[model samples]
Target: MAQLFTPLTLRGITLKNRIVISPMCQYSAEDGFTNDWHLVHLGSRAVGGAALILLEATAVSAEGRITPDDLGIWKDEHVPGLRRITDFLKAHGAVAGIQLAHAGRKASHSSPWKGGAVVPASEGGWTTVSPSAVPFTENEPAPHELTLAEIQQIIEDFRVATRLSLEAGFQVIELHGAHGYLLHEFFSPLSNRRTDQYGGSFENRVRLLLEVTEVTRAEWPTELPLIVRISATDWTEGGWTPAESVQLAKLLKDRGVDLIDCSTGGNVPAAQIPVGPGYQVQFAEQVKREASIPTGAVGLITDARQAEDIIASGQADVVLLARESLRDPYFPLHAAFELGVDVAWPPQYERAKPRRR
Candidate 1:
């Protein structure tokens, strides 16, 4: 049997296969409300045979949104619209997951399609906040440093968002600790320059993420799994290192985190990343071995043979597809054929599946 088609169970949730649809922001939302477009977008992947389909970085608070158009769970009214999408994904045999995030200093930006520059307060963007008054890029405006009181509010926001995720029927919750967002900003010394308990050392730097996970875990059911996405490395000298990521993953595992969705190099915009197929898989492998936790390998992993080797060789427990899945929603189903794994096709589309020799 192909290892890529093997089942993986985390905590009490069992994935039908190791294939996952990584969260890819659609940048098509209205005041945080999901609509028919979201249903079709996520639902199609469920039909495509991915064991899990995680939603994009859904802001826990309105300001946590990466852009004005980012999906949100800050208000109770947002639950019903999200429930509709979760229902479709589950009905199509996929486990629905969500990445709760706060963009922090990176917030208040125009969409990438709109040139992705900073959007000032008068232009519908509000003042951005972070662990320190640092802008992502040197020339951009420095964000307002978050007060201790405001930091408490961020934890509460995550708590409330976790509860709503349950109400909306999401099966898994992944905290967005990576990609140089709010949680990442606190932990990476390159972005954080605070001297308080929230910064200064590795323990202090990672304090916020651990707090959020603890607070979020309290509200989240024990039966379902909790995943944390980390940048693994800032890919710049004197920034967060792969060694630091392994240590962080160990701490997260001790706090009841089930898996590490390992990806790297989102902390600095200009840092040169060695992008290639399977480049980031090594981070996942290192963390899985050193931290004694399951990891998911992502980034440029687009082939059945490559994904199979990743799982089969014990490099990572799961392989998440982003752009590849967008290019072919049924990549998993096609992969099964390529790897000679006889998995079921959706009954409606079974006729179109390629025949065996």
Candidate 2:
């Protein structure tokens, strides 16, 4: 069997294969509610033969939403809607996971198709908050610096979200600590210029994410896996680096984090990132080697052989597909055929399975 087709066990959950559907924002919810769109979007990936399908960045609070349409798990009422999707995913033989996120200063922006601009209070957007009064860009309004009490509330929000995820029947929970979001804001020096306990020194800067991880791990069941997605580098001077990511991965491993989903360059707006095929895989390799923790390689991993090599070479434990998965929801099934690994297709589609010539 191709290494990508082999099962990967993390704690009590065993992925049928190494392919994971990276959380891609659909921006199709209302008032943080998952609707039919989420059901179909996630359900199709499960049907397509991926071992795990991580739902998009789900906000832990209304104000944490990257856009008004982003899915949320901040309230009890959101559980049933999410449960419906998880039920479908499991029935189709895929592990259901969600990325719990808080967008921080990046919140209140319009969806990408809607110009990706900030929506003002008059336009139904709320004030955004972050570790400091830093704005993501100079042209944007400065975010409200979070008070110590407000920080505590946000942490509580994550704890509550974890409980809600359990109720929603998810098997895995990934914290969105990357891509210039709230948690990322606290850890990246470029965005976190605070003198408080939550910033300044390396240990202080990582405090918020560490606290959130502690609370999330406390609320999340031990049997289930917990993952953290982090930008391994900011790709600019004085920004977060791969070294910090390795150090952070070790810390997360100690806190019961099962994997570090390695991604990069979302914390700095103008950081010159050299985007290309499997560009971010190097970070995953470094962290897995240095930190001795499982990692997921994401970013432009488009083809079967490319993904196969990632796992085969021991660079990452799993390969997460975003745009490629979007382009081909059934990428895993096609990949199995390409790699000559005979994986079972959904019985409903068994008649259409390709045969070896």
| Cα lDDT of model 1 by residue, 1-357, tens digit | 999998999989999999999998888888899988899999999999999999999999889988988999999999999999999899989999999999999998989998898888888988899999988998889999999999999999999999999999999999999998999999999999999999999999999999999998889999999999999999999899999999999999989999999998787798889999999999999999999999999999999999999999999999999999999999999999999988889899988999887
Clashing pairs in 2: none
lDDT of 2 by residue, 144-245 (tens): 999999999999999999999999999999999999999999999999989999989999999999999999999998899999999999999999999999
Assess each prediction's global lDDT (C-alpha) against the native: 0.94, 0.96
What is candidate 1's TM-score against the reference? 0.99
**TM-scores for all candidates?**
0.99, 0.99
Pairs clashing within candidate 1: none
Sliding window of 10 residues with minimal summed lDDT for model 1: 263-272
Off by over 4 Å in 2: none
Q: Give the Å error, residue 175, model 1.
A: 0.4
